[model samples]
Target: MKFLSFSILLMILHFTTYSQTIDTAGYIRGEMHSSDDSLVGYFKFDHTFGQNGQSVWYKKDLQTTKTKRFQTYKYDYFTSDSLYMELFEVMPYGFGEIRVMVPRVINGPIQLFYFPHSTPFAIIQPKNEPYLIKTANWKKRVSYRKFKRDMREVLGESSLVYKQIEQETLKYDDIPMIVRLANMNADESTIQDYIAHKKSAATSTN
Candidate 1:
């Protein structure tokens, strides 16, 4: 009888440890939406892990303990810090479907996405353009002139940021802010304000 009790205790401990390892403590709660923006259902998912390159999603209710894997959903209305952020499942050039798109500026004059797994690490779509443009990360083999030319084409001559690119004031790291400013049709004053704020924030963090 004592041997049976000891074996049951060991089994309980092992299962408890396994459950703790895979629980939804840090998972983000979101509403999965279809391509047409139709609400599917509420779910919580951790993008960090899944089976066969897909993330595991669980029903939002903790008591039910139901889970699922998804690939057909277009995007999720993920909540972080009370802000609704869209997480897109995009197929980057020369890559598989494993990567996802984190939009820097969505539905803007110039759309930019940050792809962590791809070579360029960023993708751009110019206003009213059907095809997507790929870029190389600055830390890679791409040159400054190429990066500037790409930005100029995307920003256009009418944009204030185009002039900044012409004078070589912008770098690859500034792509996120550059896209945002260009979309805003930012003037010299607005651009300067954003630059100053960003510098101040960066300094404070350090």
Candidate 2:
């Protein structure tokens, strides 16, 4: 009887330690909608232990759309957790299926993901290394004002179209300059940095 009690106590202690660790994963949740009224689906954060890939639960609203054909689906490809996810879907046109379009930059062994749909982009630079600057050196030119005018001149896009041309991204330095110029909302510290950079860029152009 004493042996049995000791074994049970040991088992409980073992599970209590590991179970708490398993339950402390991090994630973010968001809703999808075509308009103010038509809520199409939602993207839920999910995680797994000892797994190769990540998954997200996509849910559709049956009551608002007057349809019962679909319930929820799980996509199994993403592989990041506990990191700040900037945005998951496109802005302004935020609705419908949660398109998990993750564009990665791999240099040797390190990989970095940036630019979420609605979240502010995070830029992290390594200590010292070669950076692949892919876009035109617009920041080095006259000013942000002149750069916008030139974008309209060449691309005929005067509006902030940062999302459309993100695929052309190529370097770390270009990120903050572009992001600050676009005036996107971000964390307080990041916003302060953007403002400083913007002011510096304006001063440099003058």
Candidate 3:
């Protein structure tokens, strides 16, 4: 009877850790994303977790992962806006490079966007086909300078949105202004207020 009671106690403790608060400041409606659907795969979105020049955002803090130092980052989920899951380098401080994993179907082919580079450089294996790995969709890696040139050519020097993209990015600190303002209709002041509130709340918490 004692052994059975102990097992039940352990199970309760195990499941309780999976439920975590998802609201975080400076993160614009913090989102909880999970790749595995298990208790251990849920990742928390923390916008204020990195140092300058790194442009880091989400950590793999699934309550189980992040124990391994080298393999700590494995956030394989996307946002409702389809703009949150992107992999970016903030040191250059622009949208020059972006990567994301999009799910088209449950248990289907995971679409990976590898930024200014290839179209799905890595094939995320399905459960049934764990051995399948292909590079058929790989494209030439575009240099950062080349990608910037392409952006300028497409948007042109007089483009308001493109110019705003650059300006907004420079003005903001850690969060990517381009991605945050992608489909948002909020004005500049409103957005700034939101960000400021978030930062203030975060500072209070710590």
> Considering every candidate listed, which one attains the maximal TM-score?
1
Candidate 2 — which residues are off by over 4 angstroms?
1-29, 35-43, 46-54, 58-98, 101-172, 182-206
Worst 10 residues of 2 by lDDT: 125-134
**Rank ordering of all candidates by TM-score, starting from the highest:** 1, 2, 3
- At residue 97, candidate 1 shows an lDDT of 40
Residue 153 shift from truth in candidate 3, angstroms: 2.6
| lDDT score, candidate 2, position 128 | 31
Candidate 3 total steric clashes: 0
Q: Using lDDT as the measure, which candidate wins? A: 1
What's the number of clashes in each of the models?
Answer: 0, 2, 0
Quote the positional error of residue 140 for candidate 2 in Å.
Answer: 23
Q: Give the per-residue lDDT digits (tens) of candidate 3, residues 1-206.
A: 33235335534532332122122332222343456531222333432223221122343353333432211134434443323332233122144433222221111122222221122223652122101111234222223334444334433566443465355432222212322332244466644555565456568899
User: What are the lDDT scores of the predictions, listed in order?
Assistant: 0.47, 0.32, 0.32
**Between prediction 1 and prediction 3, which has the larger lDDT?**
1
Pick out the ten consecutive residues of candidate 1 with the lowest summed lDDT: 133-142
* Tens-digit per-residue lDDT, 11-77, candidate 1: 4543443233224464444454545664333444444522223354655554566766564234543
